[model samples]
Target: MEWGRCSEKELKDLEAIVGAENLSTGESALGLVSRDESYYTPKIPPQVVVMPASAEEISAILKIANPRRIPVTARGAGTSIEGNPVPLFGGIVVDMQRFDSIIEIRPEDFITVVEAGVGYKDLNKALGRHGLFFPPDPGAAATIGGMIGNNASGVRTIKYGATKDYVLRMTVVLANGKIMEIGSLATKSSSGYDLARLFVGSEGTLGIVTQATLRLAGIPAHHSAAVATFPTLQAAAQAVFDIMRWGFSPTALEVLTADLVQMLNRDRGLGLREEHTLFLEFQGASEIALEEELGAVQDLCQEAGALSFQPGLGIDERNKLWEARYETYESIKHTHPGADPFVADVAVPISRYPEILEYTAEIIRDHGVTGYPFGHAGDGNLHVVFMGDASDEEEWGRIVRANEAIVSRALELGGTCTGEHGVGIGKQPFMEREHGASLGLMREIKSLLDPQGILNPGKVFP
Candidate 1:
């Protein structure tokens, strides 16, 4: 859809609503919020940036922009790996950082009311005082609002579940500037329409979330971590299944290939084994029980033909070992500066996890494409970074083909096109292939909520 340009009258009116101090039409601000942390191309700058301080202001802005058919893409921290908050139509980018506030913490109720701009780290820091934590740490400085947008799940997702699971309520401003306070605090509600779930992963296409009430989990008293290296990637993936089937609930179960390990070692020189490894951690209240849990997981790793397994005896040691898992993305980029990184992620059934990884490896090897493979094996979410030759068109084509083949195979294995990263512009082509005719239903819902098609245009569907 061709979008209407922001006229002088419209810009002046927006400035009046948000005040001149909170809005900008400058090129620098437009470019900064143009794209997220993804390789999705052609950064389209918005006409204006609005920094609304409250939900009321957001409602008013939406009320004006929606009628004017101005695209308003809600942005939070700009940490998305999928161009989720990128403005595709060059409309208005609503900067949500000013709304940062941990409004209230109901410790006794195990729920916290926070503005959409509040960071998960700060919320957890405040919750730590009450011995509680917000689960679904997406391992980035992603705001609670963005996490809700993608329904983000991180390493701990093996145990804690995703963002949609923790969201109890939300104050969402629809496209027409109507504020709908959806969801309830009650643990179980057989109420009409689970509206909160609809918006949780809507990617701000349905409505703009201004505030959220998140469920909190208590901080476990005792926790232990272990790192084990396997001879092959399949062995590491299978170990996750074996450990899980043994009735063990590990907090985080990650799988990293030898290439990633080598990159991590060369970049950080931590002396880690350059082999396919599984970074596993267990959490509980009892120190002895946690130790036993780690030992049990280690035993399973040994049974899965692990070369060596090391269970950290202290917290610092465990964290140091686990650091390898977090640094793989940066390590790949730093190690291969000229290679354009294409980090594609997909999730399949647990039993099919190893099958897909092996399949992906075969495709990569056949195409002669270099990439780093890693994932949260505990939940069958595999993330691979294809470092395509930056200036080589032929090699870039191979990388693109490999990505397509990988997503296709994941869908064939009863998985999704995206495991955590939402269907931003990069993943649009695969929506119809993944969702089939249901893609029409999604469009219908999009049209119903945003009849003018102004909210996050040219996303989720082709």
Candidate 2:
């Protein structure tokens, strides 16, 4: 689609709706909207970027977009690892940054309503005062709407579950300017279709999420952190399985391989080196309960070949420990200056996690690609990042082969291509390999909701 073909009158009206200062067709602003955090960059740019403030305003913009057959890509913080916000098909980029506001905070009911643009960090800051938390932490300070769109979860997910589990309801603006509400603020529902879930990981292909009501949990009375080292990655994974089998749940259970530990130690110099480590954090009603959970987890780790169990440093030190995990992309890029750290976010059944890790190791060795493995083990998701010098074609080929092998192994082990990250353009190609005929039904749903294919085109379906 050509930007020149878009109606000037519509642009003028949109500028009026959101002040002229908010509307931008400038080169610098357009470049920012052209690509997301995806590995590959496309040259596409939106015809105009519109930052609307309310659901009504979004509906009005959609009325303009639908009538003119203009593609509309709804974007939040643009922190998606899969290029979910990139305007692949030139059209209007509905920048949702202006809609950031905490609509309501019901501490009594343990829920909150927030606008789509509210960042996760800011939300946590606000919730901290009420002694509550919204536990879907996706590393980056991603927007609530974007988190919901991607069904994002993080290490904290082992206890609280993913974004979809806490999302009570959402107000969405459809492609054709129809506004609808899905789900409710109540705790449980047996009402009907559960349309809210359908849009949770829709990646903006169906409708634009304007607002969300999220469930919050009261802060635990006590919290503790621990780090256990194992002889092998398999042992670390086995420790996680044992913890689950014993029916004890830690708030966070993460597996960091020796490679990842070395990367962190080399890059950040925190002296964190262990063959395989389980970074565990426990939260409970009392210090005694937290201690019991810690002891039980320590025992399981020992049974799984733990070389040593170390208590995590104080709060600040513990923060430093987890920071390395979150800044993995930066760490990899630093270690291999020109390498592209393309992430393969895959999950396996708990029983098959060890096999998947073994297969990943084989692929890494066979292809000679640098692969870093670490993720939320309790949830069975591992982020395998393939890095190779950008200028080396031979190395790039190895990276591709390694990624293919990892995804194939994951699917073979009754796992998913993604656990938290949605199937944006990066994983769209594997939809058929993963979902088979169900991919066809997904397209039908997309068509039924968005006939014009104006809402985030060139995504979810290859």
Best by TM-score: 1
> What is candidate 1's lDDT per residue for 299-385, written digit by digit as tens?
889989999998864887777667656767877888888777888889998999989889988988987998777898999998889
- Residue pairs in steric clash, candidate 2? none
Off by over 4 Å in 1: 42-44, 389-391
Worst 10 residues of 2 by lDDT: 1-10
Provide the clashing-pair count of each candidate structure: 0, 0
Looking at model 1, residue 46 earns an lDDT score of: 83
Best candidate according to lDDT? 1
Candidate 2 per-residue C-alpha lDDT over 115-171 given as tens digits, one digit per residue, 9 for 90 to 100: 999998899899999999899999887999899889999989888899989999999
User: Whole-model Cα lDDT per candidate?
Assistant: 0.87, 0.85
- Clashing residue pairs in candidate 1 (N, C-alpha, C atoms within 3 angstroms): none
Task: Give me the displacement of residue 364 in model 1, in angstroms.
Answer: 1.9
Q: What is the C-alpha RMSD of each candidate to the true structure, in Å?
A: 1.4, 1.7
